[model samples]
Each structure stands twice: as C-alpha cells, then as structure tokens.
Target: MFMDLDALSDIIVLKHVGHGLTVVTAGVDRIELAHPLTEICDLEYSGMVTYAAGGSSVEISCKVARARDEGEPSRPEDLLLTCIFTMVALDPVTRKPVAIPRLVCETPDEEYLFQAGAARSLERRTERKTSLLEVAPDDEESALIHRIWLQQLKYRDRSHPLRQPPNVLAMSRTQLATAAIMQPQYRNRHQTMIFGGYHLKQTFELAFCCAASFAHARPTFVSADPCAFRSPVPVGSVLYLTATVVYTDPAVVEDDEAQDKINKDGGDSESPALTRVHVRVDSKVREMEHGTARVTGQFHYTFTVPKDVRVLPNTYEEYMKYMDARRRVRAGAKSHRSLPVAGRDGPNLTE
Candidate 1:
C-alpha cells in the first residue's frame, strides 16, 4: 500500500500523557487501521534499528523557540522540547509509509543555555555601540537604498500569520546639528543623518543614515504612505525605505543657523538630509486551511523627527508632557521613603 502526497501530509496532533507533550501521531487518517498501524509500528522499529546501528536514535529534535500558548500575550518565548515525532522509511515488510512517536525529553543543556545567553549579551552590546550612519556614506546610492527599504517596509507585507496591512502613520528626520543639541556625542563637525522607516516593529531600525552632503536644504521630493496589502507577506521579504522630516523638535531651533552656515559655505544641505517616517502595514493569512481560522496582526510605530521642522504644536506638547510626567514619576518613586510603623510600646519596630 502506497500513500499519496496529500494522504501522507495528513498528520494528526496527539497529546502524550505525563510529559505535557504533543506528538504527531501518524496513521490517524486511515479508516482501516491495519495498513496505517503497521506503517507506524514499522516506523518505531526503524528507530530502534538505527539506534542499534549507530548507538543513537535517528531522531531530529527541534527546540520550540516561539509558539502560541493559551492565556499568554503574543510575544516570543524561550525554546522548549514540547513536541516530538519520529520519521522513518515505510515498513520494509509491508512497503508502506508511516511516522512514529518518540518520548519528548525535558533534558536541559546548560552549555547551550550559556552560549545563547552570551550571544544575546553580545548582540545587546552591538546594538548599543553600533551607529547606523557610520556604516554607509550619505551618497545618492545610500539614499536610494534607504528609499527602497523604506518603500519595502511601507508596502511589502511579510507573510506573517499575525500582522496587518501597511499604511502611512508618521514621518520625520534629525540632522547632526539637531542630534548634537539633544546628545553631546554628535557635537563634532561631522554631519550625521538619521532616516527612519517604520511599519510593524516600527521601533526597530527600518533604515538610518548619517553622512556628509553637498546640497542645500530644499523639498526635493515628497509622497504619502502607500496602500496596504490584502495578503500576508512571506518571511525575508525585501523591505524598501525612505524617510523625510515630517516634523522636528523645537529644542534644536538654534541649529537652523548652523544649517544656514553650511548653505553659505556652498555646501548643499539638500542631498544628505535626515528623515524619519511612520508607516502602516496590513497582515493577512498567507496560508490557511479553513476559511474562518485567521490570525490577528498589528501595525503601530513611531519615527524620530529632526529638531527643526515645524510639527503640530499640540501633538508635540502632549508628547513632551507625557515624557515629563514619566520622568517625574520615575524620580519620585526613587526618592520615596517608607514610613516607620510603631509597635504596641509606642516605639519603632525592629527586626
């Protein structure tokens, strides 16, 4: 008995006792158990044969790095050995395909954990030290690449089960001078351009630039956010990006004069302009079995604007107030003192 591709693909999800484990129990699709049962039994036997031959079972173990769990927020979680299934050739005696169930193990490896922790630590250090502007020149090619990525971020929907369509949310930019006013690190003569393109994960780096330019400040181009996709985007989709200052912070008003100096020096401030933009993205089912089973995806992001462009005053003020309140709350919490309780004797209690 031979199984067709669709029949072979029909895998059953089964629960295992005592391990909180789920296994792909093969042969559930068969109306008559004899053939499928034999296939499954043979699969287990094959595992035993492989173990005898190589001193280890021919089992592929994949750690579940992220999975949907009930009653938990939609966020990535640590890896766990929660699922186990064994695959082997069809029974040699019967010549039919089958899958076997293997006991899911909870053996945690300390070495793997330490290695993963070290890798994460290094990544954090890199993110803190890496300056996006330092890696690429602020040339036309760089801007073009940034523009392409911005567009991709705005338009391309990576086919994720949980995501949303792309839409225009916000946009802005920050220059070296403006950035210098906020942080002392950028005060040197070198110019740094910041371009942000946001879709979902809008907080992550969509694209950024810090570079020298030779053009005067001018509105060379502008466009609204693109349309949203009706379907989910596949993973590894090329994201296009382009950012322009939609608004700027008022604190860097003085830097406008510095921009003027660059203009007077015959250097064009137009080419290597800094920009930040917020984009929307739509999420849809890339693959589905039933018509009603769908995943809920989200699209929300914030872009960093330069400190010169005139933004909606009310919005900017609200943001500032929110930041101020948050700071105050944090500071007050740090300074808070606990009151001493008096015991029955009218004296402070001591441990």
Candidate 2:
C-alpha cells in the first residue's frame, strides 16, 4: 500500500542547508536530534551528539573536505563537504530497538565557501588563469537545465501543509540523492542531488517508484540544487503525497553530417547529447478534519541525459514509441476537457 502525503508529511521536517527532521519512526515513536551544528566536523571535534526522545538513540556525524583546483586558481574550484548522519531508530513498543534503517546525508559543502573572505585569495588567483585557457563560453542550455533542476529540488516544498509549528531539525542533501537513486532507472549514475525534508524524500521516493513501475525503465539520477525551509512539519501529522512524470523525451542523436560539422568546429568528444525529463510532485496533509485538507507545494523537474545512453538508435527509437503512447493518453484527456458537465452543479473545474 502507498502512503498518503499527509501521513508521511507528519514525521518529516525541513531545515535550512538541506537538513530534514523525522518526528516519528517505527510508527508512533518520536525522534529528534538534540544538538545541531553547521559543519559536520564540528560534531566530532566539539563532542556533540544527537539524541531521540521516548527511549531511542540517534547518532549523526559530519565532515568537510576541499576539492583540488581543476586547473588553476583562476578557474572554478569545486569543494566537497561531506555530511554523514546515521540513525538507529529503536521501536519504543518493542524495547529491543533492533536497528531501524540507517540514514546518511552527504553534500559537497556549500555553506563555508559562501562565507565572505573565505575563498577570496583563491578567487583572485583563479581570475588570472581563467582568461588564458581557450576559455570556453558558458553553455546556456546546459546551465538553464541545471538551474531549473536545482530550483525544483530546492524551493518546491515551501508551503507544505504538514508544517504547522516549525521545529529544530537537521537534514542532508545526501538523503535526497539516495532517494533519487532508489528509482530503478536512476541506479546507474554515480552522482545525484537530494533536497527537502524527510517527508519530502518519501514523496520523491514514492513518485519515483510509481514512475519506474509505470514506465518499466530505470531513471538516471543527476543533480539537485538545494533545499530551503519555509515552514516546519509537526509531529504525528498524517502526510499524503503524489508524484508523476510531467514530461519526458527520447535521447537525441547526431547524424554523420552533424558530427562532421562538430569536427569542423574543433569540438571535442566530450560534447553532451541531451535527453530531458520532468517530474511533478504534490503534497498534502491527510487524516485531518474536513475543510482542513490542503495542497502543499508542487515541483517541476527537468533531467538531462547524455546522448551516449539516450541517443543510441535503438534506445532513441524505443523511447520515441513510449513517448508517442504517452502523448496519446494526454491527448485523450484533453479531448475530455470540452465535454459538457454531467452533475447538477456541473463538473467542478480547475482553471
């Protein structure tokens, strides 16, 4: 059985810097982190620990690692900050506390880099070397796709109805990335992006499962921007959620003529072939009084798949057939939109 958005939303909380809180684990058990810190390493050096209420224990750890400069200080340097949090939820009812599932959060640390003057010295050196390379112009199309995907990951759940009274919580982007990878099709990718609260992760996982089941194709996990918290999810609220593939397209291929043109332009083999996908997520509070039902936020995501995996003639052709069938179904729905209302009050319309 699938969990409703309301039932799942009750146990999860979203915090700033992509941290999530789960209020209940193993059904009817309250869990929380006692100490929250900005940097994971602080937890270790500072001797901090996370605790759970109602006779349960949770352990979390964090660390920061710097990425080496790709070329010179003048070019962009990607730094990785890894946060690892492990939770062992003990069943309050059982008193045995067999290890509940473990949760881990990892991210390429963005917080400290954003701090003023932290990277100023490196930034100055990068400016010089950046001008010397056959400086490739920015690819706006790729950038746009990335931006949209990140925004969808970060801001889609600002108005979650389950978040009534906010609470202190810690969440990590790694968890979201893990959930995305859990989708059948996306398992092969080495990288992924995760955002939002624990409930949000559950919603994404649910949608991913549905999409995988419906399409019978595994998705390719990619990147997520960042999640920002707008409100807090309270404990013991029933959460409901729905996810769907809003748009998908077969991978594109380049003919010999196109390849020749690229060769003439001196482009490298690293040129990217693009495939796109969009996912929509809707969340709400369930198990509430009548008239209190509400929709949280919706997210639209676009994924870019490389041409090698997506554009092979066989793969492209196969995906095209699937897309065609999907389009027909959508068209059939559109045809129904203009029909006359059947009920006395007329079919309720959403505009």
Candidate 3:
C-alpha cells in the first residue's frame, strides 16, 4: 500500500508542487493483497490518478506486479497487489485544505473509472457520517459491551491466572510497540523527508506481531481500513509505532482437536473456522525542540486466524477503539461487495 502512495506522490508533486500547496495522504480507500509471493522477486510498481474531484481531493489506483527475471514483458497474471489512495492539497502556511486541479476524462474508459471512483468517494463520505466515532453505540454493540463486563466480573481472579478463561484476554495484554530514529538512508529523493513506504513497512511488521501474539497463531492478511496521514515526518526524527489488537470476531470451532490443529498449522490449515482480528497501529514522531510527540499516521489492518479468540476491553478508551474497529470491519465488507472484480483488462466494470 505504501508503494502505491510512493508512486502516486509523483502525480501530486508534478501537478501541485509549483502552486505553493502542500500535499499529504488524506486516506487509503482500500488495499488488497490479491496474491502472496512465495519467494523473493523483483516488483514493478505503477499508479495513476483515477479520480480528481471538487478541486481538493484525488483518488489514485495503483498495483504491484511481479517483474520477470529475464526482462520479459509482464502480464496481468503477474499482478500481486492493488490499492486505492486519496490525497488532498493543503495551504502551505495555513495548513488548511485547498483547491486542486480538476480532472478531465479523455476516453470512455477513463470516464468509467472516474465515475466509479466518484461513487466510492461518495460512499465513504456517507459512511463517515454514521461511523462509530460520530455516534453512540447501537443496541448490538451495547449488548456486546455488557457481555464483556460480565465476563470480566466472572473472571476477576488476577492472582490465579489459570482461573481466568483461556480464550478471553484483556486488550492491554495484546499491545506491542517499537520505535526508531529516522535516518538519512530512509530519506526520500528530496533528501529532506522520509519515505512513506519505510513507515508502512515498519508499521505492518508490528501489526502482524500484535495479531499473531493475540491469536497465538499465524495470521493471513485480509485488508486495511482507510488510514490518514496527519503530518509529515522530517528526517532525523524519532518514529514510534504502537500496534494493538482492538477487536476480534471469534470463529465457531467444532472441537478442541480442530482448535489445536489450527494453532499447530499457524492458522493456514484448511478449516471452516476463521477468526477475524483487527489491529490498529498509531505512528507518532517526537519533537526534539518541544520534548513532545504528535501522531503522524494512523493505520488499521485486518487479518484472519483459524482459532477462536476474544479481546475484551479493560478501559473506556479501549472500548471506543473496539467499537470503531468493529465499524471499520463492517465498512470493509461493504467495500468488497461494491468493488469491481479483476478481469483480463482490469477491474471488471461490467459487473
């Protein structure tokens, strides 16, 4: 997904750089790993501006394909990953959103993609109006919260660890974090900024670890929810990433034998049960002069494990994260249904 952003950043720079506007990643619409590579191989990254709207935001579609070792021509069959991103122009001094170049579709196919992107953009806006962050929890979520409280009450024997339910765990126990000092080697071509891809790679690795530790099994990548870059991190800054298993969807395992098989197989074994894990990674940068840290990026990743597990919130803050993650999961499923399927030419528009 960061590769896509890196490629798409060129378009933003070429179009808006001279206008004295600062461009930043507004959000990631979707990212899907269509196929996973089994061996280390070269990759070709390509991207395009799919839709530019309202003279403020633009949507970019990007893909990663396997690079032939013999320098042979690439094919659609080599496609490995696809992603969609949103970028917005901001006033350099005011840091407020500013107008951007309007998109002009030159061909029928371009117009088709434009319309599709516009629809998706609108859908995202609608979803945000009712997101868990904006409103109180619904009846279903309230019931789940109540159930978690009851479970905690029943298993409050902290001194006797074994007395607690084996399948249930506190959200605090699933937290994992790492920090790094941004260096010149990871700087962007301009020599003043750090590459977004570098941050992405580090964040994903920690998120994977958090999911694995929580599930006690290896996890398969599912999808990433919309992540926004709040600010840009300059070179020589300290970057910190924290990953937490905020929520989970427990799988209905048939028996203990099946559960044991899943744990032994690292969650890759073929089984009817699959638990969905939602992990949130928050990226922050330390301000040396101010002796404080500020959030620079926020990412939400989803993965699947083959075992039954539960993440119970132990505080009000954790409860909010859990509910928001649940909402993101539902929104992601809706996006999957609405997206066009990949075909010979590209995403099948006819569908």
TM-score of each: 0.18, 0.29, 0.80
lDDT of 3 by residue, 169-283 (tens): 7889999999888888887545666766677778888999999999888999987776777777788888989999988865212244543453455334355457889999999
Assess candidate 2 and give its TM-score to the true structure.
0.29
**Candidate 2, overall lDDT?**
0.30
Clashing pairs in 3: 55-100
lDDT of each: 0.24, 0.30, 0.72
Sequence-dependent TM-score of model 1 = 0.18
lDDT of 2 by residue, 91-152 (tens): 33553444323222222222222221123324335643642232432364235334433433
Worst ten-residue run, lDDT, model 1? 44-53
Candidate 3 weakest lDDT stretch, 10 residues = 342-351
Q: Which scores better on lDDT, 1 or 3?
A: 3
Off by over 4 Å in 1: 1-276, 282-297, 301-351
Better of 2 and 3 by TM-score: 3
Most TM-score-accurate candidate: 3
* Runs off by more than 4 Å, candidate 3: 8-23, 40-42, 67-77, 89-98, 157-163, 251-272, 337-351
